[model samples]
Target: MTAPSAQTDRFVLDRMPPRDQWPAFRYDLPELRFPDQVNIASRLLDEAVENKGWADRPLLRSPQLTLTYAETRERVDRIAGYLINELKLEPGNRVLLRGGNSIGMALSWLAIVKAGLVAVATMPLLRAAELVQVIDKGQPAAAICDARLLSELELAREKRPGMVRHVVHFGSPDDPQDLGALAARQPPLFRACPTAADDIALLAFTSGTTGMPKAVVHTHRDVLAACECWPRHVLKAAPDDVVTGSPPLAFTFGLGGLLVFPMWAGASVYYPDAPYNPETMVRQMREHGVTTCYTAPTFYRQMAPHAKAIGIPTLRHCVSAGEALPDATRQLWKEATGIEMLDGIGATEMFHIFISSAGAEVKRGAIGKVVPGYQAKVVDDEGREVPRGTIGKLAVIGPTGCRYMEDQRQAKYVHEGWNHPGDAFLQDEEDYFHYQARDDDMIITAGYNVGGPEVEDCLLAHPAVAECGVVGKPDEERGMIIKAVVVLKAGQTGDPAMVKALQDHVKSHIAPYKYPREIEFVTVLPRTETGKLQRFRLRQHTP
Candidate 1:
């Protein structure tokens, strides 16, 4: 149950899936309970300054500016005033956000939610073709975009002329129509909207690493509840910690790891001025005095070789998600920096990490026990619990779960009080959850089930292999054959002897029958902007 809504525009609220189809939520932790009327942006910023006494603590730090808690609240309030008083936007009007992980982008996102508007954030690399899909689905009333990335968004807006009525650009100091300039004109004190805890706060679209994208709906309570679970139990973040990461704010992994979790712990996030590469990321961590880091396994793999050379003395915690953390990558990073990587598995539907272990609790090959506030089990195809050590779909229920907006896939994601995250997993006697491959990505060769990650992990350990992706290619005789598309190291050549050496390398390490039957060498592997390997693209393009 929830308090009365304060939103005037019910476009998103009206389209929410029926209540009966929703996953059951739990509030075992004291912090998970919240008042019926609450706004996340206000609860995170204003309460921190006014009640928690973080007024003078540094909050948002970037190359351009560093703002204390009180100063950030003032900027957020002015932006809220511009959204409400100048733009004439009513509560619950969706505001589309398009930008990189910059100070301007963070302020815009906080202001949108503070004013009781639904924030729809898109990836910075998406072109007009992909942007149109989000615009048609979210049907936003206004947009706040980075001035540098405005061209593609403008092209998308031309296709759907009436979808978004207002637009403002940020990150442009000289433009009078920029968001910061307009925000400066408004009073620095604006009342926060009284949104219900259950009111929709953001619409997060899937990264489409697999296929079609789905819009995930999350509430104010969902955001705060997530902050209570993972960070409190596993992360144990301190107020003085400095956080830095490569995941973009558009991805939910970044949104929580980089922004929401840091704010919850009263930590500061330092955004680098330049886009991160392996060299740049390591150098930035050393220069910025970062204590906590977050990125995917792919980035960690690439950065492992450079970590010790550049030196990051202040770094203590390294969190990996967005994709599976292969044992090879974890070992590589540990050998380089001597810091045990914290591996967790989370989905956009679940909002953030539900299963993770930090410090000495981390297991060798399993994502640790469920966070204090969540429950997870591996279940067979028919929705019954499977025995330990048996691979099945991963079902989870927590403070947050899947709530898709007007998508038929909602039923497939949520059923019988549990949200199935579409991944295959197995539980051990110790209750550690071991990740298999995505249910659809599992390869069947000669009637034997082979997880692609197991083979890819073996290949990653080889000296000549820089990167690789494994998929099942259709075959007339054997049903499907395991195909490996590999990217060799700079000095390595893909000759006949080299292929035989790699094939022999896999046979010696893993099962001989599970080796890749077909191998193709290329300069680079196809990957999503978030550093996830695009297996679907490999299935399409691999010959």
Candidate 2:
């Protein structure tokens, strides 16, 4: 690793764990080798312009317009120049990005990276309280946000005055200080920062499903390495492929799938004008000729029916990874599109999917084999490797691993050079990993242990069920009882008979003990913005 330069901003670097505490970062693959001083934005964007074939290829496309690789690079350079010359942002200063999936948001992210600043991209739906948590932790010097989503950030700014010195908005004609206005005044040429490969590139905050969000720091090498692994081996997208997805750019999953992977493959990404629901996603894919997609299982389940009705002919690869991909959902998607959904497991800590399978390598119910650049194992609580087929915590080490920003929880997440991602898994004889549950999500009912996802999968197979969440409810008799909170399908009645039918369905499908002893029907189940079921919320509802 290269030593930090005097010009490099040390805010994030100063907060990172000492060298001895970091998980072992392996660069065994020849492609994973990075230069001492590297700027990922230059590799992903500027280098493409120098290539004959890739220079003119479309990089980012929306309903309104398309940006070629050269065009996108120019815009990135201008924005980066504006940040440095106009806003006086120093290298390593954090820049908060707030926006939905759009060309502007993508440009802002690349600019931040090019400027050698840490990008703290927040979800569009995040409120003032949530924004404050990130602001307090990252202490960003400036924010480049979508104008429409400025209210909450403004509120947060009011609460944390002096933390953020400058604010530039996009998608706002009324605002005189919009990013576009500032960029236009600057020259469209700026030298990429000469930062080290280990220099922090971005601060990816976790969804905070269980507690306050933790900022997962990723280095320039980490981001580049992630692109090399999954996109190179698993996804295998071509230059002509048009990619689209529902995950917001704020999420690492979205950032990789939508922007990074496409640029890495010399492929193009299509961002929709409006947010995509199931129907809209199908329509947009068909209209724009999208060949690759990345979204959650719930969205896939919803889109499967529409895909069957009006086929998405151009779509060849559909990647699912925010939560575990239920077998039922996978089968349904395959039946609908005649294409198997590529399932993978990744965390904010790891940057992108480290375990996944594409094409013929995909197993029926497994989250595929570990990617080429990574290693994983099922380990017991004591960090010893567990026997195959034994449920234990999943530990992983790769080119990109967890580095929390100034958080004590880092010790808990990284132990003895391995990242424990809090999920339990069992590896089979074939070396394929099967997700059981989050260590805390496993339910112990009447002395029988059950994975909540297994019960939810069984319930999802039933025609009457739309969505469901299972949790262990406190009980006086048994230590705990398996309780289910279900959302019925449209026009389906949620009565005693329906509940009994679901219970009976689960009993018939799997072990009888796994069936929910108590079932409560509701209009909807609580979920994160990324479509992960908030099982903790369901547990709170349970007695």
Candidate 3:
């Protein structure tokens, strides 16, 4: 699964030498499979226990609780034994985990993996409809949910019975089994089940960006494969550094950044309950001497305005994903904190970062060069490679690539040994890729392939438009009309004249055809917790 050389276009890996590995750039990469075969939990935890001798080193930090590595591993083993012996959780049994940010939540996640059960961590904010939808799709045999959120799962059970027969309460003991008591009954040590490379370890569902949601089956290798790329080419995370963040552990971005990445290097992560607020997060960063931080671009934008107030700067590196990191946000952060935030684009399918700048390759606005092992090129609808600097659908190929849970989307993603997620981006002459909007989000009007994000950037430039969503609407003459759904600043009114002014403003800033044919103002647009604008939702209801 090696990428082709930079000069030649042919693909080669273990069987053949990379055609462009000119001047002795070849390094042998060991092909180690993921959890099923290698048992990452045993490899990381047991190895740390033996060599490092986990002696009360702090692993989790919150306003209320502080857990050490030895304590964490003990709890993880207890829960693993309890899950396997008591619950009879054999390999491949799907288990849904729904809970708020807590240390218990983190331990439970690892325990499931240790027990060889497939873990599906859903965002805590999801309600009955979303819960029932995933449960119906995944048919999880059991669910571990906080008592506070138990009512939602109950409602979901009403809609889809027999989906989850067993429920483990996180907040209290309601099922004759508490996480602590259940673990205490089992042995202190647990060994991983003999598994294979392709064993499904996680079934991460999408945010339903395009349409109905579907499960994404990630192998044990995919989980460890992500950690493989982190230090190899992407963020060079050291073992002694501490990782902290604001994303829920449920999100793949958060799981990799805060939990897995740190564990891969035998480092610790700080998890606080009330630290989601920017003010509290900064306080945690200073108090904990947090070294690595991964969060969304919008969170950075919110923090940049008030960065000066939060002092005590010991942070080393920061990463941004989930949404486009606006240059305005990046520059403001650097000016305020003296730390440059690296931006990258990753989806639910790929698990970890694929396109990011690392080391000294910061380009401010441009997403960094394709990873050394990954091959990314701009291609047309037919999957033919396009010339550099031309905006087209961005396709990727690498050792650690995508494998969709189903067939239809998998066929669409895998083309000519490449994976295309329908994102439109342009590659610079220097091999860096700049993200355009999604191909489905492109607003075509009057025979123009106007990218929605390009128009949204223009609208974002306007001071009045606090947030905006651009989409193409049905039209009588021009095939499709450009429509902009806008959220103005507080106390601002959306009048007909204001709409006209916004249209005129867009026309002035960019091409005339990019002007919004329709503008509707609202207080707020739909957004995922990661701050990614839900354009499909906006299009469904508004347009």
**Best-fitting candidate, measured by lDDT?**
1
Look at candidate 1 and tell me the lDDT of residue 454. 90
Per-model TM-score versus the true fold: 0.98, 0.98, 0.88
Tens digits of per-residue lDDT for model 2, 314-343 = 999999998988899999999999998999
Residue-level lDDT tens digits of model 3 in 292-359: 88887767766665666876477888788887776656766788888878888877777767789954
| Decreasing TM-score order of the candidates | 1, 2, 3
RMSD of 2: 1.3
Which regions of candidate 2 fall more than 4 Å away from where they truly are? 173-176
TM-score of 3: 0.88
Per-residue lDDT value at 228 in model 2: 89
CA lDDT of each prediction against the hidden true structure: 0.91, 0.90, 0.74
> What C-alpha lDDT, on a 0 to 100 scale, does residue 111 get in candidate 3?
84
